[model samples]
Target chain A: MAAWGQRLAGVRGVLLDISGVLFDGAEGSGVPIAGSVEAVARLKRSRLKVRFCTNESQKSLGDLVELLQQLGFDISEGEVTAPAPATCLILKERGLRPYLLISDGIRSEFDQIDTSNPNCVVIADAGESFSYQNMNKAFQVLMELENPVLISLGKGRYYKETSGLMLDVGAYVKALEYACGIEAEVVGKPSPEYFKSALQEMGLEAHQAIMIGDDIVGDVGGAQRCGMRALQVRTGKFRKISPEFTASPPLFC
Target chain B: MAAWGQRLAGVRGVLLDISGVLFDGAEGSGVPIAGSVEAVARLKRSRLKVRFCTNESQKSLGDLVELLQQLGFDISEGEVTAPAPATCLILKERGLRPYLLISDGIRSEFDQIDTSNPNCVVIADAGESFSYQNMNKAFQVLMELENPVLISLGKGRYYKETSGLMLDVGAYVKALEYACGIEAEVVGKPSPEYFKSALQEMGLEAHQAIMIGDDIVGDVGGAQRCGMRALQVRTGKFRKISPEFTASPPLFC
Candidate 1:
């Protein structure tokens, strides 16, 4: 199956993670790694279903797609999938939109979340605009509603910088649960069901995609678990794995 | 119980991830989160069990304690437990690790899997480093042995980046099986027996020191199905939901 790269002569489908594989982790701006753009273009020419699977809770796929295109990459918003968007799915299925911890970076994604309705989905996040006041507001709605819940605990750090990674606002939402008492609903990777959901968008077997990323354990490890061929590209921050660190350890601990 | 965090003034046993949260992803440096020192101090001042847990694949509780101290967690590694480390408990008791996958990440985690000993303790996911060649190595050994399989699809990003959220790597490992056209062993989460192996740790009940990760559907959700009050943290990457994307939501599709 993996022979597709050699047999078909280009990646037929790609489950690319943003920030590391493609971008350098700027909030939304980054240079594609050497050979990454050409690699993507080659895949595109083959009509591969190139989907961007990101843990970034900050931006919508549409917005991210535009940014990627502007950055001289062939991309589309429909090709993007993220955790923040999972809230919309749970709400529709359960008939409950409860409350949401969102980011100003991707607040527009909530347009499908029905935030304007007086009794519709609630809004909450750890963005600079977030506050105890906003959390309290969400708390009130949660306490008052028959079934109040959270869209997600935005613990993902989608876009990164060179210095280090930051909390993926979802972490703040998780903290809110400790801040309060009720547990929030979640819908992202690490959650295999969420991966199944993402797979639905790709129209490919979960086993067919190759997850290429910079994070060794996060990107490569997770994909390996879900039954996909994963490549740990040294293109991102994880490459700094102390070259002294055993790449091919003998009798590993 | 969570209200305790409210009534109490200090953080208790800071729940930590094995690799990145405590140790660096590649086993390089133990770059702990900032405030860890103060959190430990505060927890100590508050008089709490300095307990910790991890998803480590290469060490026993004793080895992890040493590593934790070496990494500046200031806690005994004996106080820590990796999900895979407990495999010894089961294999020693049930007398089978299954020769299926033949491996998992971190060889130290599975002390019982002796490839030369005609055992069932299959070693599974070693990472992208785990591939067809490795599977063939596992298979060559397996064809000669006989026992239930031990499949190790390392779920979620085993290696991570400073940017993207955690992803699963099992997809590739499973792909190996697809390519090899054979079934392997099973020895990880959702393996009901593994839970007992963990419970045996610290002689605690399943109610004590439980793992609270994402996957209300997989880990938490399934646990609830198995009679457990799972706290589903919505922090992982796939938390968002859009109503339009529901399986039946024509708008989403």
Candidate 2:
């Protein structure tokens, strides 16, 4: 831990991804399947930013924070961001009653659906319940309407499990538009709003924080494009971004 | 338009992006913007699947198809799909009622909000009506309750408009989860279910079809990983993925 901490000497804070960087995206089991817990604990003890963001829309920050605490790290919900809650914020801010366009796992977010006007917010996620019909409706909303906005553009890759496979919202957004005639305006990931939001929350300028993640777009490239130094990890599905990266690449793998 | 179309010839099908690809994210502009209609027409005459997909949550397939036809493209509504419609199919199939979500322009799709249970499905699309009050209720349903599902893992980039910068559903998804404890289950891009669904819809075997898009994980890499030939466009971000395909230091780029 000391040696690893020293590697990030000048780095003010570290933006870590939960699944691949900290935990191994597993539930009903343990925190990690490898040495990730100890590694994360070491990072936290070193007093880094330890901010975790993920394209994963499965667990809430609170849920993840509790799970992480049990695993070994002391963290709070403030250090995380998932897709579900993000969409809700936009809908609430707009004051529109939206019909949920998502799976059974995420239906609890919107308790009320207003019908004064047909204008509503559309939230897309990666879940088991995503089907053609849902996509059809999403397409309808994106294409037919004159002013539709997309929340994020972080592309999700398929995370294979033993039972079957599921989609992340990235694909759903693309597919919906293909089926519909509208195009959604994305707000997350490579978008500056998300980066600024993170910086604003941490009380640091973009130059003050170091972004880290398993993905090329969200972690490495996204940060670099937004004026932050990035440290790519070998954890989670990190290999997909840089498949050629073996034991290490130019920088810390 | 003619020159670009000529360059796009060998590509067989053009999997155009909905946001900046066609009308430049114009909502309710009334008619197609000049060459957009002509470009699409030439592509359609060339027997291409001028397939369109967007991250916008504003319109419907029927409307888009009608609009495209009005703009002079040989298109049909059956070929479209949006997040709202997709969510509808998933929820209705399993006999589940979902909490509705919407963005600025996609409120029309959720004229019917199904909430028969405490499990809320958070659907997010880009529209003028999405607001903060909506986020509050969604947060309550998700955080207050245990394991409440929040759907709508949105995707797409942000569009700069005259009024201001607008967000898509994907970004909204992230905000919702940031406020609440529950996470959204994503169901787009690189999700095998969606890939399979597309293949099934075409009545073509996975091996026989080729998927094309600009994103790596969602288009090229996603499809390739799922056992399909993939071609990624040079445009958009992630240029590092296929940087200067003219040479090769790595096998998989």
Q: Can you list each candidate's DockQ?
A: 0.02, 0.03
lDDT of each: 0.48, 0.53
Candidate 1, residues A1-253, lDDT tens digits: the string is 4753473343346777776677664534656666667777777787667777776655666777777788777777677777666766666666665555455666676676544433333343334444433444554454344444655633342224553333344434433443233465556644566556667888877667776665444456666787776665555544242232224211101
Model number with the top TM-score = 2
CAPRI classification of candidate 1: incorrect
Cα RMSD (angstroms) for every candidate in the order listed:
18.4, 16.9
lDDT of 1 at A30: 57
How close to the true structure is residue A122 of candidate 1, measured as C-alpha lDDT? 35
lDDT of 2 by residue, A1-253 (tens): 6975665456776666665566565433334536666666677788666666655555444565787788777677777655556666766788755545554444554445453454643554535434433443444445334565545435553332222222345555554443332455554565566676776776676676787665565567778887887766665554432333544332222
Cα lDDT tens digits for candidate 2, B1-253: 6964553344444444333334333456433334556666676687544455433456655666666676565667565434556666666676656666554345556556566564666565545444433543454455434456776634543332323234445545654544342367655545566666555555555565455454545555556676765665443332342222422121112
- Please give the lDDT score at residue B55 for candidate 2: 36
Q: TM-score for chain A of every candidate model?
A: 0.72, 0.77
Q: Which regions in candidate 2 have their CA more than 4 angstroms from the true location?
A: A1-9, A26-33, A111-121, A160-166, A240-253, B1-253
Interface RMSD of each candidate, angstroms, one decimal: 17.7, 12.8
